[model samples]
Target: MALPIVAMTLSSCGRAPELRVNDAVVILSPVDSNPAALYFTIHGGPEKVYLNSVLSRSVIRSEVHESKVDPKTGMVTMEPTRKIEIPAKGTVEFKRGGKHVMLWGVNRPARQLKELEAEFIFSNGDRIIVDAEVRAATAGDADKKDAHSGH
Candidate 1:
């Protein structure tokens, strides 16, 4: 019985990490000249996962970023990030005024697209493809407000 239990535990430990993305959206630039922001909720599997980067043919470049507010100055800023860690059996949210994927130099066709397909690359050599809804900056105001409030 003890040997069987040990074998089961070892097999489970070797399982690959699973990732699921939900509520994915892309906020297009108002003038189609600036970078777009991508938001989503990512759920990790049994093991912790590191999100290394995002890839899309629609944009010239893409990177992960984190937003922060200066409590004293009341100023908001965004900083580039290399990786985002998703806790095991937990979720990470990328929303407005928080951690998000930045897409730069979006092509004209992509900007006009209703939805875009993107690939999320993990540090452990796993890639997941997802379709993200496109939204204009003027749209999703209610969602943005909630995101800013950290809800």
Candidate 2:
């Protein structure tokens, strides 16, 4: 007589999550109302994301900007960047006191909270469209549903 045998198998049933970005905030100072700054964090995907360009109707132009803090001179300077690479499985945070987006030439005042259309052009030929809410400078105006929220 032979004993019966039993076996079990397991498998994954869902597609892997795609690369994305979150918590995109564009801050417009009261002084330089025309030109605004953008800050956001990029979520998972590949090792890096090439930010081709940024678009908005409210502003004439949008560019990636970075800040340089000099320890010796105790001075901080900022300049325009061609593109930004968001690390894969990592996080790229664009904060107020750090690297951000520079939006120039605003004809109207961005006082009230409004949804501004922004299409992020990537080197991979992928477009990530985000609705940026225009509010006060100090206001926490970041996307909550984005992957960057949990972190």
Q: Looking at candidate 1, what is the lDDT of residue 103?
A: 86
Model 1 TM-score, all chains together: 0.77
lDDT of 1 by residue, 60-96 (tens): 9998988888899777777888999989988999988
Q: Which portions of model 2 show Cα errors greater than 4 Å?
A: 1-14, 32-34, 107-113, 138-151
Q: Please, what are the lDDT tens digits per residue for candidate 2 over residues 32-116?
A: 5446676777775755667767887778877777776778986666777898886666677887556778777644644355556
Model 1 residue 83 distance off true place after TM-score fit, in angstroms: 0.6
**How accurate locally is residue 128 in candidate 2, as Cα lDDT from 0 to 100?**
88
Superposed by TM-score, candidate 1 places the C-alpha of residue 131 at a distance from the truth, in angstroms, of 1.1
* Predicted model with the maximum TM-score: 1
In the order shown, the candidates' Cα RMSDs to the true structure are 5.3, 7.8
With a 3 Å backbone cut-off (N, CA, C), the pairs that clash in candidate 2 are 38-101, 47-88
Lowest-sum lDDT 10-residue window in model 1: 142-151
Off by over 4 Å in 1: 1-17, 139-151
